[model samples]
Target: MTQDKTNFTSQQDRLPPQSIEAEEVILGGIMLDPSAMSRISDRLSADAFYINAHKDIYQAALRLYSQGLPTDLLCITNWLSDNGLLFRIGGRNKLASLVDRTVSAVNIDVLADLVMEKYQRRQLILAGTEIVQLGYATETDLPVILDEAEQKVYSIASEHSASDLVHISHALADTFTEIEARHTGKGSPAASSGFYDLDNILGGGFRKGRLYVLAARPSVGKSALAGNLALNVAKTGKMPICVFSLEMSTDEYVQRFLSSESGIENNFLETGNVSDSQWQPLSVAIAQLSEQQIFINDESCPSLNEIRSQVRRISSHYGGVGLVIIDYLQLMALDTDSRVNMAQRVGEISRGLKRLAKDLDVPVLALSQLNREVEHRNDKRPVLSDLKDSGAVEQDSDVVIMLYREEMYNPDTPDRGIAELVVRKQRNGPTGTVKLLFDHQFTRFKNLSRGRSF
Candidate 1:
């Protein structure tokens, strides 16, 4: 036992993965040719250096470059001295030695990549150590522990890998290729919302890596709209759809889908009171829905981490996910302590969903509830400010769509049975109101015909 403990200690004492020579080369090359900083600035940070002194030297050079000044040895020494970090970084002699050893900045890019690789390895090791510590935290819940562990590992893999800047010429070439592909009917950069007017207003459809928020007062059909969108995406059969139903059960959602697809009354389906005539449409609806790839999780008030983990799993299993829909955002849980208030928790949840959309490279349609302030107004139309709990929902979303039903507010109004999808905010397109015919019996919304009357 004593010998094993000694070996373990020795292993732990070994230096973390790093390339000192690469760090020296990068610092030296930057000082030798100040222009080299542009090539490697995005790829490497000062923390990439293994030694503290090397980190300080690189940081000083970064400051000089950012200020539109030369990053020569003398400037670096003066900057370090001015910052009172000269002796901490081994004095002026250290900067002189780095410049003296390097001849050119021709290989600075390669050295920068090598340094980043070492830093990433060290980060992985540290993540593993933290994960081990989490494993020993018996007081924490298992799911929370697992989620934290995954987040730590994921950050090291993704957040640390900075992308190089692409020149406009190269970017234009790729854009042209995409445009040609679209023209040839080979592919599209967006997925259709399955509604003609909505698609037009969305500049095509829901784009990948975007967060779309659908908010409304109670009984205005935001969940129904989300369900409709999900069913449409699933029907495309191009990619799988994942739905997290925090407020509804999987059975209830499926029943709603059946009623919507069959044009039958939702109450009839819920009560299992289908007539002989309705059985045929119900069967056909079931068959059609079964052919599509849709997965649902009905865990009530699931934490954001749980949703993220499940989405990742489904995405991995299905090759890719076309869309992810959360039944409602306000009901989702955030695993936070007592220090976090409700508003802060909701803000974090909103931001986490946005990040999840970007990380998974899929569109996330999150249903939100409008605040009661909308009801107090004479217009009763929700704006971006009506998003409940926190303003972060509007801030984090790339698009915000609010639902309004005149019939709900004014039963005798001429627009009865018509629903208005108010495009309150669109990041890349014009915002306007889209009218759709709503069938409360079937719990569905469809495009309004020009000549049709309620």
Candidate 2:
């Protein structure tokens, strides 16, 4: 009989070692509801005044009504915490009726013996056993829990060798499918800012989830170009856009936009050189701009998380934000812990911008500063190598462009107001030059082509 009992013993019949909490270890090891296990586990880790594994189930019912694992657990905990009750093993009624704390049976052998008289208890264990055995799920209601757990491991895996190729391929294929869907001639209600070369270069206008880096030496009109694009996107009432200015104030950006829209000139606005008649048109343009769906956030040195949070809030308030303009990429701070190289950081930032674009499903236009190497070159036009940092930026970016004007180098050059939009790298299509009209007085870019003009 002793030998028979030994042979018949189950895995859960083995009790946890004394070093670990027996209740928690037993629950964690079993093929039971993971949410139930998680609540018990959490209470032990924390210096909780109390703990009731069923408390989460009860609280989830009280809070979310029909809560499932994870969500149910969180809802119950949050509700209990908010109500001034200790999140512990025993629960209280509305009038604080005491509940006797009963330790869950840790020994499966003991549990089996007890369940022999109560068959319902044994059925509960068998119900979710298949998924636990297969490692497909943590609980019946939390089918995707293991999937998320796997992703967490995969994200930081040091060695993604030959075996990870399948996962990588599927992710790439899904991304390509989404890209193909968006690339197919989708039109917006906004009027195209006239400038055929610029329009052709940008594939129409400042799109969502794209960063158009307008890089230059210290005084090469990075702000001016950014302001121009902001104004252009804003003019299209149909495609709403928002600009986050890290380097400039909202008023400063607005003035630049007005200078571009009203033809009041940047110098005139800064130096207060405008006539009374010019103020009328400027005021009119301001009023017109106010009614448009253009939003500007001028917070300085915002982290990527802050930027994303603001974008989410703005998108939530407005139906959705179509274009997000970051005055410059390098100005933003990385708040997440990263011991990676500077190149890796820049790549991470670049990847994040791309992700934001895909998440929002819109173009992200970000200005960038070119390295001094552009100045060292005989031709001052910016090149791909001059991009601030990282091979990842060049690799992950869908389109890489540089704004260069020869007139910025030599004032005597005949093409004083002409800007060359060099498509240094185009991942999806052809690489070419698109000529744009750069109005020096008013920071604006307009289409030189006949029909594309707004």
Candidate 3:
């Protein structure tokens, strides 16, 4: 029994998942039919073939196809010969054999899919082996090891082939479908900021796969605005909202949300000084908030990789997230050499966040700090150039909303109770300012009155 078990283990270890027949059929089919390459080029790559010789042949054919040449047997042979890979792939006889074995290219697509499945299985096995090695490395921190293991597995699961170009007709069809959905009241492909005028200025609201930078000077209510928007999305959208509170504790953020929802002063909540009448609304707000799907990570100075891993875990658990809000961008940690400048570090962070938004297909609202240069200027309102440490913030973001409260700088100004959300850079829509009522006490923002001046 022991010998049999050892033999079984050895056999399993030697043979990784593969389908040589399917790989051969695909390689042969591409040469047999000139049009077969087009059908599977996007779905299959040379790496998907388990056999090295097949990988070489398929790669040769791909080279031909890329150069606008037909991937017939003769072309593949000549290309492989010119590249000195003909002998490495078993020479011209190997190509002839594949063609002779393949009757037609009818099943090439299905065969390609099978080869890809085998490839993915092999990849998963390799990932598992690496994960096992990671487990044994006690020198590394436990969280780091776990994160590396999860990333290894996640990469395999989320791997995608390079996309092919789509014709305009197909693009138009998708656009019209989305438009029809909105026209029929199904839903818009955006999440409203819960402020009416702001929504209008944002086309509808924050869109999926886009980074929205909310920049302001210190204490200008960017964090408050992000919290409010996150709460609004959690309340309205069916999907969960993730908040990475790099600057504040989760308790602090929850208190602000409670203050906004219950109409209680944030200071009162922080101090546990709620009045008798405030208890009722506070209770109601707590109940409402308890039902909302909002996940907060109050990790201080978390790196981008850590954030991505947490977001992926939360998204996997809750089906998907509607939005991801980073409390403040500057505070997030970046692992880089000491020689790298802060500006370049920040640019890398912004680009990484943009890519994260795209990968998760959710809107990412990142709160940023404006440089003090705005303070020296006559107009305290921030512009794209005021984005601290990086211009990539403006270049990568789809929308840049600068929060300006004149009261912050000039306490006696007419806009004491008003907040201006200057839509400075909008990639897809008009740029303008949307005014809202800023309630300093409750740390909340609301739509301005119809006839209100400031």
Candidate 4:
């Protein structure tokens, strides 16, 4: 039994280290090859240089043979280099000869000790770490591992449900901080800069993270009204914002901003009707805006991922993004050219925007096209159903706001120029309407009459 134990140890020692065993030390204690580890490490996407256990010429040859390379010294060095572990060439054949020469003289215990020592030496040389310490060694005793805050963020994820439940826990708790006065919860409580009665009815302004869709017939100031609200937020420094203009250029959009800031009509800017004295206000507004963090990304159409990436970049570089405005949702790109209905594609886009808002913890304001059913109705005012393409928009949004100017459809009416800000759905608050004053001169809208007095 004693002789059998000796022979068993000797045989195990002579059999050579398994590629899986070597990799066990390289990565975690589990078995894996370098290629497998590399893939598991996401292609080693960042620049990182680390060393591993040193192998003898015979062991190197075994590795080379397993990897389908020539069993020669040069080939061994080249293989290591190609696979990202590198060593000098001259030592290989000498070590191989030593392995064959010293095999009988070497005891199993001595060889194991040598292998362990060499691993420590290599790790010490490559990484300036104390191998004996609990958390600093690489080659032996578990690669020194540490956790990062950002990685912890990605490592955690929950099993998503097969279907969504709309029962948002309305338990406001204390997560709701009063961003404005007179509001005790998370929903928008500031009257939109439209009409006072409308503000009182709608219970304030647009809610955070809610997708506000505005649709209109051919040319009923869609851009104008959207621009007006966006500029109001910018001018007031209300919150960090973004404007995705699918239909206009940055230059044209700037023209609209200039009109709003100067209280000058677009017609004046286009036809030179503005007096020279008015240039001062435009200049001041321009200078002030240059210092503010309001952003405008005017791509004709952007994919949801592309937008997410852009938002990530903006947030990282610009100290976080707040409000996001998409000119229209129907223009968003569908994931693929499968013959899916427009409504499904719109739903996907709407869902994506909502997720993005929650993920980034910001509000998303999107413009939408109203179905012609709105036009056919006697009221001509848009309702939740009039939202183009997707009823999902109403379902997913915390608030759904639609714009309808009575004058847009009727040439001569008492409400001629009166724009109604209808809150079609308030996921967490009262649903109602607000009226806004549409000033053609500035091409902007404001509360009919209110705070800081327009």
Q: Candidate 2: where are CA atoms >4 Å away? A: 1-194, 206-212, 334-342, 452-454
lDDT of 1 by residue, 1-454 (tens): 0011111232476766778877888888988899999998777888778788888888888888889999988899889999999988778788888888888899998888888888788778777777888999999989899988988876776765446678999999998997787677676677777776887688667888999999999988888888888998777637899999989999989988999999999999878888999999999999999988889999887788888888887776787788999988878834454488877877888899999998878899999888899889999989888889899888899999999999898999999989998999998889999888898888888888442110
Give per-residue CA lDDT, model 2, range 1-454, as digits (tens). Answer: 0011112124466531122133233322222323344333322222111124433333443344334334323444455667665344344332132111223324533332232222222222333353355465435334244433333333322111213225778889976875565466454322343455566555565555565455566667777776766666556535567788888899898888788778787788988988988989988888887877777888786666556666765675676776787877666634334576567776777788888776555677667777788888798887888887666667767777788888877989998888877888765566788777777777777655565422
Per-residue lDDT, model 1, residue 220, is 85
Choose the strongest candidate by TM-score: 3
What is the lDDT for 82 in model 2? Answer: 70
Candidate 4 lowest-lDDT run of ten: 42-51
lDDT top scorer: 3
lDDT of 4 by residue, 1-454 (tens): 0011111232353532223222223222101122332222221111111122323323454565456554443565566567654444233443344334331321323333344444333333323222124354455323113222221222221111113433344434333444433444334433253445544554555555455556665566788877776766555434566888888888888888888777778788878777989888878878976865677888777777667656655765666665678887887744334599988888888898998787665667777888888767788877888888888888877777777788776778797667777777776677777777777667777677564321
Ranking by TM-score: 3, 1, 4, 2
lDDT of 3 by residue, 1-454 (tens): 0011111232374777778888878888888898988999888878877778888888888889998999999999999999998888888899999999999999988998888888888778777777778989999978788888998877777776334689999999999998887777687788877777887778667789999999999888888888999998887787799999988899999999999989998889888998999999999999999999999999887777788888899888897888999878777734443588878888888899999999877899999988889989998888899999888889999999999998888888987889999999999999999999989899988889453110
The runs of at least 3 residues in candidate 3 whose Cα sits more than 4 Å from the true structure, single-residue gaps closed, are 1-14, 67-104, 134-148, 161-164, 179-185, 273-280, 333-345, 373-378, 389-392, 409-414, 449-454
| TM-score for all models, in order of appearance | 0.70, 0.57, 0.82, 0.58
Error of 2 at 262 (Å): 1.9
Report the lDDT of model 3 for residue 295. 91
lDDT of 2: 0.57
Error at 448, model 1, angstroms = 2.3
Candidate 3 at 4: error in angstroms?
Answer: 26
- Clash totals, every prediction: 0, 18, 0, 10
lDDT of 3: 0.85
Residue 3 displacement in candidate 1 (angstroms): 23
